[model samples]
Target: MENLKDEQQNHHQPVKIDLSGSSFWAKKGLKSLEANGARVDVYWDFRQAKFSNFPEPSSGFYVSLVSQNATILTIGDLKNEALKRTKKNPSATEAALVSKQEHVHGKRVFYTRTAFGGGESRQENEVVIETSLSGPSDPEMWITVDGVPAIRIMNLNWRFRGNEVVTVSDGVSLEIFWDVHDWLFETSGSSSGLFVFKPKAGFESKSLSFNGRYGDGEGEDHDVEDDDSSPKYCHVLYAVKV
Candidate 1:
């Protein structure tokens, strides 16, 4: 887990509870900790968790973050289990997933999933990135969402760094920025591509920042008051060729 930081810029070290290994106490439990002047209760059970290519579990487990007798954040598919163990009702305002970073390794294709929108309208969408860097044909790339091709870049050599706005639902859209210069120009085998996905709205006042040339563009920075009506979320994926 990453460190928790509040809006006041105070950093709180995360408490780690190992749920792995053969130890009998490592499977399920509840932990109480204090952070930023608040009591946080963590309830988790991973005895029958399932995983995929990622290190995080994919299903069959529950990790709930409770505070003030309310569940704020819940992971995995066992929400009901978490509620039962925590003995707390879901918070009126659930925690927002502000940002996520994932590293995926593949040769020419990379896959991931992310949820867009918030509240009742939120929906998960599958993202598939396919690249053709070498062959008789010119280098090209295709980005698909929910098994549908959403964005296609032809002649990737000239368009290696670009941004596109893709529509995910009727009234939901996201801005995608990609930088693959390292994959094309760098001779190092450790080269990887960067892709950023952010919702079209809510991020106007405070957008995700990147360290590369993509950060040098105009309108990347905004100074405005924070709006609770529109929550911000961002997903960053690093595709490493292997």
Candidate 2:
């Protein structure tokens, strides 16, 4: 966020971003999939990523595009300090980010609208790119820009990793296996409210009439938590499948 117009995607703040071709994030396990004909990249743009809130409501936290071994890119404080709006950058996140539009699908994912930036600059919302993750694997993440599908991670075998996380994706579809045995039931009061992204599925991608409508900022204010522990809050996911 330091220089919005910079060509390189580097946020030179406490939370740094790696723009070098050799990204800090690891893609070791992903090679086999590549051998099987899947695309590869040094860094990954985490779709609809969430961060654990800092102690101070204003002082925010950071999230990274990390692999099993290293960190790739990290966005410092996803919110705008001056306007209290979400931060967005297409070149950094590798998604064509647009503002004031709805459901820009595929690689053209929408980040939050630039509420308090310089001029009234909002990326066009008509372009679409072909971006996908590996297939035949569990889902690592399910991300959407506005109401349009963005990126999804697959084959992320975190079951044995043992950190209370489960993510998998396959470029096209996504599946998530959660192991919050410790985070849920055992805990209370904002216990399960550590995540943001509100997920709701439509009837089907083909049938707009029956696929339901996607409202703007529908899930923006979800789990509004200041911290992750010692508080009282419960997170709920409203997903509708047809």
The prediction achieving the highest lDDT against the true structure is 1
- Residue-level lDDT of model 2, residues 122-212, one tens digit each, is 1212111121223554424444433465444344343211111211121222111122222223333322211122111211111011122
Error of 1 at 176 (Å): 0.7
Candidate 2 Cα misplacement greater than 4 A, ranges = 1-143, 149-185, 193-242
Q: Estimate each model's TM-score.
A: 0.62, 0.17
Instruction: Report lDDT (Cα) of residue 42, candidate 2.
Output: 31
* lDDT against true structure, model 2: 0.26
Q: lDDT by residue for model 1 over 107-159, one digit each (tens)? A: 89999987655433457778899999988999999998888888999989999
CA error at residue 175 for candidate 2, angstroms = 15
What value does the lDDT take at residue 115 in candidate 2?
19
Please give the RMSD to the true structure for each candidate, in Å. 7.3, 20.7
Best by TM-score: 1
